[model samples]
Target chain A: MPTDTADPRYDYALRPPRLPQPVDESLASAPIDLDVRLEMYRKLHLLRQWSKRAHDLFLQNLVKGTTHLSLGQEAVAAAFSSAMRPDDYTFATYRGHAHSLSRGMDPGEALAELLGRKNGVLGGKGGSMHLTDVTRGMMGSYAIIGAHLCIANGAAWSAQMRGTGQVAVCFFGDGTTNIGAFHEALNMAKIWNLPVVFVCENNLYMEYTPIDLVTAVPRPAADRAPAYGLEPIVVDGNDPDAVYLVAREAIERARRGEGPSLIEAQTYRHGGHSRADPGKYRPQSEVEAWKARDPIPMYHDRLLKLGTPEATLTGIERQVAEVVDAATEFAKNGPEPGLEDLLVNVWADGGAEWRN
Target chain B: MAELSYREAVAYGIAQEMRRDPRLVMLGEDIAAAGGVFKTTVGLLEEFGPDRVRDTPISEQAIIGAAMGAAMTGIPVIAELMFSDFIAVTWDMIANEIAKTRYMTNGQVTLPLVIRTANGGGVRFGAQHSQSVENWCMMIPGLKVVAPATPTDVVGLMAASVRDPDPVIFFEHKALMATSEEIPDGEIVDTLGTARIRREGTDLTIAALAAMVPRALEAAEMLAADGISAEVIDVRSLVPLDTRTILQSVAKTGRFYTVEENPRVLGWGAELVSIVSHEAFWDLDGPCVRITTPHIPLPAASSLEDLAIPSVQKIYETVKRTIGGAP
Candidate 1:
C-alpha cells in the first residue's frame, strides 16, 4: 500500500534499463488513459497476491502437486489483458495463473482448481499446471514447452478462415525459443499469414540454468524472430506502460490480418521454476536485482507518480486482499470429486469405456 | 454402384464430409497440389479449393497442433501425418494435447479432428515409414483409432471419423492403396466400433485390421480348401474396439487368432487377446494366438520386408498349425 518511491520493499538505487522506444513507430507515443492504467494496476496486484497466496498454500501442503509462479512477471499478463478484446484467444504456458486471472477468470474457481476441489475450473481435472477456462477466452495453459505456439496458430487459422477477426495471443518462456515447435509455429504463421501474436516472457532463466548459458544467441526469442521474418520487438517486461504499448500495437496488427509478431518481454520470476525448485543455482545478487524490479511495486510507483489518488490505490489494495481471502476460503471449503468423476469426459459419450 | 481404389476412397470420403460441413478443413504435406504422396487426397484441392485444403511445411508438430487448436475452437480439421511412422516426431501434440485436452478440461473443449496417416509395411518403405503405429495411438486414453481395409470401408469410415465428436487417428494402410472395391454410388457412411465378418465359418475366428484383414481373408479361403473353417472379422476401430463382435465370435468358434501388422510386442492384438481371455474364459477352448511381424525395425530389402510383415501364407500356416495342435 506504500506510495512513497523510497519504500523499503523496492530498491530504487538499481534502475531498470530504459525501453528502446516502442516497436511500432506509429504507436511510439500513444497514450494509456488513466482508467486503463488503473485497471492494469489492479490486475497486477490481483495476480501478485494470487500467486503469492498459491505459493503460501503450496508451502502449507494445501495446494497439492507442483506449481510454476510468475511472481515478478505480472506486468506482461496485465498489460496484454488490458490491450486484448474479451473474445481474443489466449494460449499460455504452465506458468500462467496470473495470465488466467488477468483474463477475468474468477479467482475462486481458479483457486479451487489449484486446490483440487470439485468446484474448480475443469472440475479440478486440470490442476495448477493445466489451468484452463475457454469461456473466458483463456484457452489453455500447456505444460510442455513451446507446444502451445503451434496450437495458437490453429486458433488464428480458424479465425482467419471463419472471418472472425479474432487474434490468438500465445505466451511462452524464453526456453521455448530453443524448441522445434517454436520455429515451426513461427514459420507456419508467416507462411499462412495467420493472425497470431507469439509473446515470450523471458524470465532470464530456463528452469535452473540461466537462459544465456544454454541459448546460443544473446536474446533467445527476439534474436530468433528475424529468422522467421518477424521484427524483433523487445520490451521492458516489468514496466506496465512499456508492455501495454507493445502489446496493444502487436495485437491490433494481428487483428488487422498482418500476420504474427514475436514480442520478447524481458521479465523475471521472483521464485524458482516450481514449488520443488528452491532456485539455489541462481546467484543471490542476481535474484535480488530482479526482485528489486518486481512488476507489482514498479507499477504501483508509476501509478502514484501519474497523480492517482493515494486513497484510490489503498482502496484497490483492500479490495484485492478481500478477493484473495475469499478465494482461499472457498477453495478450502470446496468438495472433492467422487470416484465416478474419473471415468467421465474421456470421450464424447462422457465415459472411458472403449468397448461396447 | 461404383468401384474406387482404396487411395481414391480416401479422397472421396474426405470430400464427402468436406462437402457436408463447411467448417472441416484439411492440411498435410504434398496433399494439396501434389495430391498427396499416396495420391489419397487427389482432386481435394480442386474440389474444396485451397482455403479448405492446405499443404503445410514438413512440420508434423505444427500440422497436428494447428488441427488441435482449430478443433478446440469452432473449426474442425483433418490433418495428415504423411506416414504413420512419423507420429514419433509429433506424438506430444496428438497424444498429450489433442487426446487429453477434452478430458483434462472436463469437457470444456471438444477436439473434432482426424489424423490420417499411411500405415503398415509391404512396399518396402523401410522401418521409419512402414510402422503400423495404431498400437502407439491405441494405448492413449482419449484417442479414437480406426483402420479400414477395403476402399468402401475407407470411404465409409473416413466419413464416420470426420463426423465423430472426438479426435480419430485414421490409419490408411500403404499396401492396400492400390486395391479397389465396389461401393454404393450414393453417400456411403459406415459406423465405427463395428466389426465386419468378412467370411463366416465355425472352426475358428480370425481378427485383423487394415492391411492384415485382406491377408486374413485369403488365409481363411486357403484354410477352407483343407476343410478347416475360419471366420475372418475386420476389426475396424481399435479404441472403441468391437469387443462384442469379437467375444461373440470367440464364444461360437472356441478359437481366436489375431493377424496383426504391428510387431509382436504390445500390438493392438495384445489388448484384444487380454480382453477375450478375461471376458470369454469359459468360451475359449484354447489360448488365443497372435501371428504378427517379429519385433524388429522393418528392413527396406524387398524379400526381408515381405517376410517381416504378416502375409497371407503366414496367417494360413499359423492358424493351421495352432488349430491342428489345439484340443
Candidate 2:
C-alpha cells in the first residue's frame, strides 16, 4: 500500500501475473524423480547453511574480504542448475557462491579462495567476487552490474557457431535490467538466435534502493523481453519445482535453436546486500513474510507430507553438515600462495613485467 | 614481395590468419558491409561471410566484452573500435575483463585476442575522434601495445598479434594508413620484443613509435644536413619492450631523445626516458629529451591540431639540444 500502483513511474501495468507455487499436480507427476528431488533439497539446504557460516566468518573477522551471499535465494540456484546440462555455461553476479556450488564447483576450493590460499581457485588471485571454474562451466562471476550480459551472449554465440548444443545462462539481479547492456545484448541475441537465457533474480532491490523507485516497469524481464521481440516468463524462485519446470522449458527451447528467452525469478535475499550492509532500508513486515516462505524448511515439510521418510530427510541434513565441515577444515589448512604465484597465468608465453 | 598500403596490409594479414586458422573472426561497427569507416576491413565480409566478419552495433562495451568472451571460449577474435578515442568506453573490459581474464582465471583461459583501432591526429576529425591512446593502454599490465607505422610493420605486427597467446592492442596511425611499403614474400610475422634501427648514428638515439617513427626518420635526415648523426629507432611494441636494443643504442650514442603523439607528461616517451635513464644512465652524455604533444586535448582545426603534435622540426631541435651543442 505504500507504493502507488497507479503511478506511471513504476511499470506495474506491464508486469505479468505472478506464477503460483505448489500446483495441483501431485509430486509423482513432477519432471524430476524422487532421488533428484532429494538431491536438490540437500543442495539448497547446504547452500543456506553455508551462507550462514560465511556470514559468521565475516562477523568474526576471519574472512579477509567482504562477500555477497544469496542467503534466502538458494532454491533458484538449485532448480535452474539441476535443469541445465553440465556443459552449459553460466555467468553470475557477485552473489554467486550458491550458483557455483550448484554447478559442481568444489566447496573446498571456494572456501580456500575465500581464505586467499595457494590451493584456492585462481591461487588466491581472485577472492570472493571473482571466483571462476571453467571446468564446471561457471565461467566467471562479475562484480560490476550488467557487465556479464554480453559476455553470456558471446558464449551462447560460440556454441551456435561451433555446432555445440550447449546453452549459456546469465544470472543477474533486478537492478541490472536498467543498464544499457541489457537491451543491446538482448537485441543481438534475438537477431542471432543465440542459445542464451537471461535470468533476472528479482530480489526487489538494487542494493538498498527499491527496484520500484528506479525501474520503469515492475517486471523488467517480461516488459523488456517484448521490446526485444521475445516472450518472457515469470516463476516463484523460492519453489524449486516451479522454478525447475520453467527453467527446463527455457533451456530446452534455447538448445533447440529457438533463440534466447528472459525469465524473472521473483525471490528475496534474507540478508543484506553485502557484509557491511544491515538491510535497514527494507520494511520489517516484508522481511518476516519472506522468511516464513524460506525454501529449505518449506521443501522439507512438503517432502515429509508426500510420504518421504523422516530418517531420509535427517540423513540429508547430516551429509550437508559433513560437507561444509570438511570444506572449512580444508580451507583453514590450505597453503598460502608464494610470491612467485603472483606472476603466474599473466601471460602464456612467459612471466609479465611485475613491479619489484 | 608486394607493395601495399598500411590499410591493405592489415586486411591482408587478417585474411591470411583467417585462412590459417578457422577460429579467427572479426567484429566491429561498420567493419562488415561498410568495410570500416577507414576502409581497413574492406573485402573481409565477402571472403569470410558475415559470421566470421561481423558488423556490430554501436555498442563499444558490448562489442569489446563479447569479443573477450568469445576469445575465452576458444575462438580468436579481432575486435576493432572505430577510433582510439572510443577506447575510453572499453577501458574496463580491456583492463579488467580481457587483459586480466587469463591471469585471474588461474591459467584456465587463453585469449588470442587483438584490438585494432586507428590512432594519432593528422586528420581534422575533431577532439573527440583524435587521440593517440597507446600510452593510455601502456599503463595497464598484461597487455601488448603495438603501434605499426609502415605497411609492412602493420601486417607483421598484426599477424604476430593474432598468433600471440595474450591480448594485444594494435594501434594503426590514422594519418599513415594510406602510406605504402614493401611487404616481404611469405609470412612476415616479427618477434614482438624487437625494435627496428631505421638509421643508426652516434650523436643521439631518437626512439619513436607509429607516426613518430616517420617523423624521426625525417628529423634524422635534417640532422644529417647539419652534420649531426642521429640513430632512429622504431619502438614497435611498447609492452615486452625491446629495452636491450634501446640500451645498446644509448650505450653507443651516449645521448637519447624520444618522440610520440601522446602528451609529454607521463607519455609513452617518458617511459622510454625512464628505462634508458635506469639502465644506461651512466653511459648518457646528457639528459634525455621527450618531444611530444602538448598537455592539452587535440583541437579540431587543421592548424591547431598540427601545432599540437610533434613535428620533424621540433624533433630536430630536441635532438640537437639533447646533445647540448651546435652541430
Which candidate has the top score in DockQ?
A: 1
C-alpha RMSD in Å of predicted model 1 compared with the true structure? 5.4
- Per residue, candidate 2 scores C-alpha lDDT tens digits across A119-188 of 8877888888888999999999988877688889888888888988999999999999998878878888
TM-score, candidate 2, is 0.95
Judged by whole-model lDDT over C-alpha atoms, candidate 2 comes out at: 0.85
Q: What interface root-mean-square deviation (Å) does model 2 yield?
A: 2.5
C-alpha RMSD (angstroms) for model 2:
3.8
For residue B262, give model 2's deviation from the true position in Å: 0.8
For model 1, residues B178-228, the per-residue Cα lDDT tens digits are: 999788888989998899999999999999998888889888999999999
TM-score of chain A of 1: 0.91
**Candidate 2 segments whose C-alpha is farther than 4 A from its true place:** A1-29, A354-356, B325-327
Report DockQ per prediction, comma-separated.
Answer: 0.80, 0.55
Q: Distance from true position, residue B246, model 1, in Å?
A: 0.8
DockQ of 2: 0.55
For every candidate, give the share of true A-B contacts it also has.
0.83, 0.51
